[model samples]
Target: MSIKSASLTIVTPNLADTRKFYEEHFNARPVFDCGWYVVLRLTTPYQEPEICLMSPQEGMQAFTGGAFLNLLVEDADELHSELTEAGLTPMMPLEDHPWGDRGFGLLDPSGVIVYCYHPIAPSAGFEEYIIEQS
Candidate 1:
């Protein structure tokens, strides 16, 4: 069967702060917002998202860092500019990847490593494979 895209649920320490970080920086708004969990996404026109902020427990150390997700954007540089204007410091500057994604990394309010990227070119191999489908 054909599959769609993927979105990762990242358990965070502070849902509000994490939510604000994503909303202000990446324009991720809540599709579902409960006290313990939330589903956030970018706005219309560019609607695919790759990460979500959720809350497991207040201090589950395992859920704190590198909740290990990448968020694809139309232009990482433009997002960076917006984030800069919003006073968020990028964990890394935008850089070119040999693998074809122009990207940078950052930390969410809850300490998750978020990679913001735009594909510079099609992926090297597996042209037929959609990551969400594989």
Candidate 2:
């Protein structure tokens, strides 16, 4: 069976702050918001690939954030500058990786690692692992 869509939902006490972080830094728009829960999307013309932020419900555990979110963007350096100018600091500075990524990491309000990257050619040993699409 083909998968239609998939999304990751994060439960946090800082739901609003997290939502705002994504909205301001990632160009995310709220597709759904009910104060305690919010659905955000970075793309305007498509659905799916959403990030959901929710306040922990009664009897539920809130996320303390050992999560990582990877965002593949067109220009990592430009986005890095923009985020820095906007007063957000990167947890990991922008750099090229042997694994074919030029990326940086930032910690969100809830302590999640939001890594933003762009594609780059992998170093020799790493190139063999990349699967080319048919």
Candidate 3:
């Protein structure tokens, strides 16, 4: 089956900080920003995996996990470096995936994992990359 949209709900002790981090690095801006809570989308010139940032009221049942939310990039090393230089510590470094992708993961305030990546031998023709895998 083909995959479509993916989403994750997040929480932070300080929504402002988490929001700013995403905005600064991924160039994501909130479609709805209430200062304490927001819903963001990546701005022009950047293709993205529709992501939303949610910061609920204290004690709300917000989703939390160590699993990853991935973002595809052409160059993981460069992007990872830029993030590190800007003072964001990557929880993982560029590494080869057994499934034929190069990538890394980052941990956010809510412990949500974010991955930046590029598929190895990435297909320009959709057919090639759509092969079924176990």
Cα TM-score per model: 0.73, 0.92, 0.74
Compare candidates 2 and 3 on TM-score and give the better one: 2
TM-score of 1: 0.73
Ranking by lDDT: 2, 1, 3
lDDT of 2: 0.89
**lDDT tens readout by residue for model 2, 3-81:** 8877889999998899989999988988898988899988734444789999999999988868899888879999999
Per-candidate Cα RMSD to the true structure, in Å, reads: 4.3, 1.8, 5.1
Candidate 3 residue lDDT tens string, 53-131:
6666767866556567778787888898898888888788788765667888888666777899887754455446656
The weakest ten consecutive residues by lDDT in model 3 span 121-130
Off by over 4 Å in 1: 57-62, 121-134
**lDDT, model 2, position 25:** 91
Q: Give the TM-score of candidate 2.
A: 0.92
Better model by lDDT, 1 or 2?
A: 2
Ranked by TM-score, the better of candidates 1 and 2 is 2
Worst 10 residues of 2 by lDDT: 41-50
**Candidate 2 ranges beyond 4 A from true positions:** 44-48
